[model samples]
Target: MRSALIVWGGWNGHDPEECAAIYRRWLHEDGYSVRVETDLQVFADPAIHELSLIIPIYTMSKIDKEPLANLVKAIESGVGLAGHHGGMSDAFRDAVDYQFVVGGQWVAHPGNIIDYTVDVTKPEDPIMQGIPASFPYTSEQYYMHMDPSVEVLATTTFSGQHAAWTKGVVMPVVWKRLYGAGKVFHSTLGHQAKEFENPQMATILRRGINWAARAEA
Candidate 1:
């Protein structure tokens, strides 16, 4: 059976613990053996190298350098990495290697949280096929520092919420990247547990997990 190691917990302000639980339940129901943990050191376990996927439900936490390094190595050797919003992107701010592998960093959500529309740029991708080309949701409108290597699959344009100079900006909301021998998928949604209950989001996330586990090149 495929295994997923979920590491959840960090600033409660981000509600990662609750979000992690939501994912644990989702994956369990989907028939994957899932192990949930709050610590970051599990990356050091040689056994972690055997897992098919690793989900980081952690946001803005200081990770031990050793384990962080080990995680990079593990994924480099072929382990899928997947997560959404701050839980994945905001986990290790000071670790360049972490950001290097993950492919982006959260910068700001200019007008705080607001309703926005997501446009699927890659409708043929399995994760996006059933999803409508455009949909509206009330959540954080993320401004990210994206990597050039990532294939952006979805984007959201700033909806004129503020009279700032950046009003017409469009940013990636979901993307995928091949890092070393592993795969990485990130969606800038899922700021709250309620968001995960969206059928579209659930299907997108499920496909992302499967995509990340694909055989390495």
Candidate 2:
């Protein structure tokens, strides 16, 4: 059976535990055997490489060197990685190595929380099929520094209503990339667990996770 590990903890404001539960339920529904962990040490285990997928819900925490190394190694060994929002991009503030594997780093949300639109630039992509070209959304509009190598699936344009200088800037909302032999998927949606209640956000995320879980351990 395909298995997945969810290591969730860190800033509680993002509702890491709550978000983890959501992922756990979704993975279970998809027939994946899911394991949940609150400790970062789980990443240090060599057995991590035996799983088919890893979903990180940690936010604003520092991971130790040994565990970070092993985590990277597990992904490079063909284990899949998928995550959303700050849980993945903003999870490790100081670890550039983690960012390297994930393919992007969270910089700012220009406007803390506001109404925005998610434009599906690649609606034809499997992860995005059936989602509209654009839809109304309300959350943090993430402005990230992304790797050029990532395949962007969706994006949002800053109206500059909150930050004037960013008025017309287009920012990536969802993307996928390769890390060594691993498949990496990410979305900037879901400020908290509640956002998953939105069908569009939830559908994109679900398909992204399933798509990224292509490689077997």
Candidate 3:
């Protein structure tokens, strides 16, 4: 049986606990033996290397050097990593190593909590296979600084209403990349657990997690 770890704790404003529950349910339904943790120390635990995937719902928090290094090493050794929104990209703001593993960092969210559209960039990709070409969404439109080599599966266009200079700019919303032998998947959706109620958002994330698991890789 495949094992997965979900470490969730950090800004509670993102509802980490609730998001963790959702992820746990999904992992269970998918037949993974899921373990959840609320501390960053789990990153340092050697057990991480034995897991098939790691899902972090931690946002805007500090992770110690030793733990961060071990986490990176585990992933590089073939463990998968996956998460959405700030929980993944916005965590460990100062850690370049974490950013390298995640493939992107959340820099800004113009017009916070507003309506926007998500455009499927690679519908043929398994993570986005049945998702619509474009779907209306209501949440923060993330403005991220991303790794150039990551494969983008979905994107969103800024209207320039909030940041005029950003108007006409397209940004990646969902992406997957390889970190050594690991498969990393992320989506700049789900500002909170509620967003998961959206079928498209939920479906895309579910598929992304499955795609990122070590078994799939």
Best by TM-score: 3
lDDT of each: 0.85, 0.92, 0.94
lDDT of 2 by residue, 68-185 (tens): 9999998887899999999999988899889999988998987699999999999889999999999999999999998999999999999998889998998899999989888999
Clashes of 3: 0
- Tens digits of per-residue lDDT, candidate 3, 145-201, equal 989999999999999999899999999999999999999999999998999999999
TM-score of each: 0.94, 0.98, 0.98
Error of 3 at 189 (Å): 0.4
User: Top lDDT: which candidate number?
Assistant: 3
Candidate 2 lDDT score relative to the true structure: 0.92
Total clashing pairs in model 1:
0
Better of 2 and 3 by lDDT: 3
How far in Å is the alpha carbon of 42 misplaced in model 2? 0.7
Ranking by lDDT: 3, 2, 1
Q: Which segments of candidate 1 are over 4 A away from where they belong?
A: 214-217
Pick the winner on TM-score between candidates 1 and 2: 2
Any idea what lDDT model 1 has? 0.85
Ranking by TM-score: 3, 2, 1
